[model samples]
Target: MTMKKLGFAGVMIVALVGLSLATQAQVKKGKTRPLTTKQMMAGLVKPQCAGLGEALKAAPSDDKAWEELATKAALLNESGYSLMDDGRCPDGVWASACKNLQTASAAVLAKIEAKDYAGAQAEFKGVTASCGECHKAHKK
Candidate 1:
């Protein structure tokens, strides 16, 4: 093929791949789905946060307790999804804080999975920091 033709084909392939990825991301997000703010707080965040606190206090070595901790961490991650829905982030501050929450949640999950309580404790502070930052800036 001519050099011009080859270059054009390459650009077209890159664009198609990018478009395919974007579409899959949208479809995947639709499946998981963000909850409304109230639903997130009542059903996901509040309960998960409280449960995580209790689990920390207990710190049982049993598999079930650890599993609960992991679940709470995963739910915390999911709760951030509620904040990140389209039209939910009214400003940059909220968007940034929500991103922090998601990052902290993932860190917490990894720490708990490794049975690293100290690390998890530190990461949980990040979660709380994100929460406080948002509330201070946005909440009434």
Candidate 2:
């Protein structure tokens, strides 16, 4: 290869190596900042749960609302499952929280389907209670 081409290749190699080292340093620094339970729950799970709550309040008798709540609950449960898989929390705690949330949400949907407005409202309260209970225990 020509000297000019070889020199250009050498510069590129040096730049790549520098970039790699910088990235590794940043990753190490980030790891040192350890994620808090509140941070994870608020960032990754709470928005969806809040949305489900809003939808439930506004459209208690609406099929679409019930379906949306079910979908959001499922997503939250999956997120909790993922956290457990990553060893971020004990499997039992994670599973219990997810299952409680899922069950309560599903109960609301079922009550709505049965045209039991009062029952649905009660189930909605149960769902919120489940979320609160889990947060109290596991969230920061």
Which candidate gets the maximum lDDT versus the true structure? 1
In candidate 2, position 51 carries an lDDT of 77
Question: Which residue pairs show backbone clashes in model 2?
Answer: none
Q: How many backbone clashes does candidate 2 have?
A: 0
lDDT by residue for model 2 (1-140), tens: 65577698787987899877664443222324465445656775678768766765654556666566667756665654544443344435556766676677677667756756667667767667766766676554
lDDT of all predictions, in order shown?
Answer: 0.77, 0.62
Regions more than 4 Å wrong, model 1: 1-35
Q: Quick one: best TM-score, which candidate?
A: 1
| TM-score for each predicted model, relative to the true structure | 0.71, 0.50
Residue pairs with colliding backbones in model 1 are none
Ten contiguous residues with the weakest lDDT in model 1: 23-32
- Candidate 1, residues 14-72: lDDT per residue as tens digits? 78998776644432343255644556567778899878867776455888888889999
